[model samples]
Target chain A: MLFRNILFFMGESWKNLFRNGWMSLASIGVVAVTLFILSVFVLINMNVHHLTEVIEQDVEIALYIDEEATSDEREQLVENLRNHPEIKKADFVSKEEGLERLRDQLGEENGLLEGYENPEDNPLRDAYEISMHDPEAVSSVAREIETYPAVGGVEFGEDVVENLFDFTGVLQVTVMGLMVALALTATFLISHTIRLTVMLRKREITIMKYVGATNWFIRWPFLFEGFNLGLLGTVIPLVGIYFGYESVLQWIDANLKFFPSLIPLETAMGQVIILVVPLGMALGIIGSLISMGRYLKV
Target chain B: MIEAVNVTKKYNDGNQALKKVSFLIDRGEFVFLVGQSGAGKSTLFKMIIKELVPTSGTLKVFGRDVSRLRGKEVSVLRRNIGIVFQDFRLLEEKTVYDNIAFAMRASGASPREMRKRIPQVLEQVGLKKKVYSRVNELSGGELQRAGIARAISNRPAMIVADEPTGNLDPQTSMDIIKLLRNINVKGTTVLVATHDQQIVDELKKRVIYLEEGRIVGDQEKGAYVRAL
Candidate 1:
């Protein structure tokens, strides 16, 4: 009996959907546009994170060892730094290599150095270029490395690391705020749509109530209708997200070839597909339920 | 069997729709409640069906106190007490068959039972041939028959019809009264609220007359009496 009623309910709900074709389309359109905007926000947020990570990878701490340190001591210091959980990579840079790099940077400005003694006479200590696992981890790792007797000084762009961290924090907050606002807007729009639909069926509902149909029996089909509308709305936006993410990645790859390790468009697309469908359906169901709550009482 | 003990109903606007109305209707008996507009015939019908709670009196229908019924209990009570509206309250979007089937479904009738019983009810109401006809396509008389078919689809213990024949032709009205009488003879209590003097005089069944939300007369085989 329950199964049969469910079937009949679903059939009736579908008929209602077709009967109110333009209204259903309008509701679905609202859902689709809202989900599309939400998906775009998600994609942009992910890509921004990817870009920031790339920039973070390039900022590293340079640790200069004491001049009196032996090769073995220096090797031990390098090994210790490598084993540190915060360090991504560590390599030794000899004094000669550092002098050569400085000279390369000062090319064609040798006139300023002509009257001065040979810059190589005061050989700088061997230094270890250590990339931390994350830009934020640099300060703490540098402090730990400073405790080593073989280490003289540590240098890294603290301001850049702080700026990157702050940027990510602000992005997260903004995304959260935008998501909450969009969710409220979606709820308002979808609920009003359902309210209008319920108003149109007010007589039918009143008659059903007169005929002794339970609250659940009358409510289930309408709720399912809303869920179906939401699901339908999700289809177009999901497909659009997939194609849009791919096309944007393609454009970036073709035009901005300098940036490497861009986030895979497929991964971002998958995330959006996973998130938007449930969100849309939840909004739809909640909206329908709220409207039904008022109108079904009769 | 239905019984009201001094039932009273007052609307929010301070209009008293039913005022200390009391009556008893025996099982398997047909009764006519006659009154002019705003005389509380509909209010009495609403009370019997538990659609409106009395302001200060008890109403018992089919051994249940309708005055106190709520939630699933009200639905359960309604399942055994069919109601027909004067407007024929059929779902216009549904076919005659679906309209009757919906009544059975709401009462939790099994599909097998529905399959066997829906056709039988439609046949009883002479709507067997028009079972699949949409309500909008049916004539005023046919629609009334469809409404009757839906009312009796569940074989309810009692049927409360408010102005069932008001919109039908004289012959169609007689046909509807005869149909209700037939169902009453078959053991379902039937209550018809109408002011059709011709039908009331012709049928000569028990009559309860209401005037200004109060029963002014009760008679056996009565004529329609106009009371202000």
Candidate 2:
């Protein structure tokens, strides 16, 4: 019995969708545009979040080791840093390696620093670059590392980290608010579109009501119609997003190298596809339900 | 089968469609609710089908107070009382067979039952040959017959047809009236609201006459009596 009704409603829904061709197209058009806009926002938000995470991961406190300190003391300091739960990794950089890094950075400018290249005259310090698993803990870790007697100095980009945190926080809130507003607007548009379709069939609906059809009996086909429309609307966006995302990613990689790279398509595409289809269907269903409430009142 | 006690319906615009009307329609009786246009005949039909609620009275059908019925209960009440509109109200795209079958399908009758009952109802309404024809292709009388078939397909206890033959020619109207009479003979209570005085006088069934939303005359085997 249930199976029969499912087929009946499905068939009726399909018929209604096609019978009113222009209206159905109009409905699908609205849904597609809404979903496309929503997908664009999601992609932008996801990339922005990814960029923030990358910047946060780069925050590190550099603890300058005392030149006279013994290797055992250095090892003990490393052990102490690692014992702190917030410290992700503490790697020691010797003065020689630091000097080599400076030379690489200077490139042709190394000639200017030739006099300071001698091992006896080397001014670079042996330091531990302390990485924190939680970026918010960077200042606390820097303060704790400063108490070490063997530490000559502690340095990190405190102002840069704070600004980045504040900016990302605001961006996240704004992105979330935009997504909610877009969802509501999309639902409302879809409902209005479906309501037009319902209005066109008002006579059939009134006749159905007169002939003893239950509210669900009258409602299910329309609901299915909305679901199908939503599913149809998702098609263009999914095609655009799935195939388009890679090209956009490649373009960014080629032209926008200075900006942090977006999350790989392989990593991000799955989440997007999962979200878009269901969201599209939900919008369609909600819109149809809202329209159905008016007609079913007899 | 149906009872209305002092049922008064005041519209949102403050127009009173029915004023303190009281009547009881017994089971298996054919009734003619004769009235002029705007005499509240349509309103009374709407009330009987539970489409319109009485403003301040108890209206019951099948022993349930319809004015207080919930959404689900309304459909149940409607299932037992078939309603036919003057417009024929058939889905023009659907065939005559599908039109009648549609009603059976609404109440969740099995396909086998639908297949069996649909032809029977169409035959009962004398539309056996027009079963596969689309409703738009049918003439005025044929469409009305299909509408009546759809109404009686569920074997309802009562059939409330509001101006069923209002759009038909006099000859065709007589045919449709006879079809309804046959269904009444088969034991369904039939209530027809019409303004055709010739047919009303000819049939001479019990008549309740209305004028300006008030019942002015009630007679057994009544003739059509126009108000002065």
- State which candidate has the highest lDDT: 2
lDDT of 2: 0.83
Q: On a 0 to 100 scale, what is the lDDT of residue A289 in model 2?
A: 84
The best candidate by TM-score is 1
Q: All candidates' lDDT scores?
A: 0.80, 0.83
Model 1 clash pairs are B8-B55
Name the weakest run of 10 consecutive residues (lDDT summed) in model 1 chain A: A110-119
Model 2 chain A: ten consecutive residues of lowest lDDT: A252-261
- The regions of model 1 sitting more than 4 angstroms off are A44-58, A61-161, A173-175, A251-270, B226-228
lDDT of 1 by residue, A7-48 (tens): 887787676677678777877877887788788877767766
lDDT string, candidate 1, B1-228, tens digits: 788898889999999999898888898888899888999988887777677888898888887788778788877787787788889998898899888877777667778898999899988988899988899999988998898888888778889999998988899899888988888889998889996887898898899988899889989877776333
Model 2 ranges with Cα > 4 A deviation = A19-167, A173-177, A248-262, A294-296, B226-228
DockQ of every predicted complex = 0.46, 0.57
Highest-scoring model, DockQ: 2
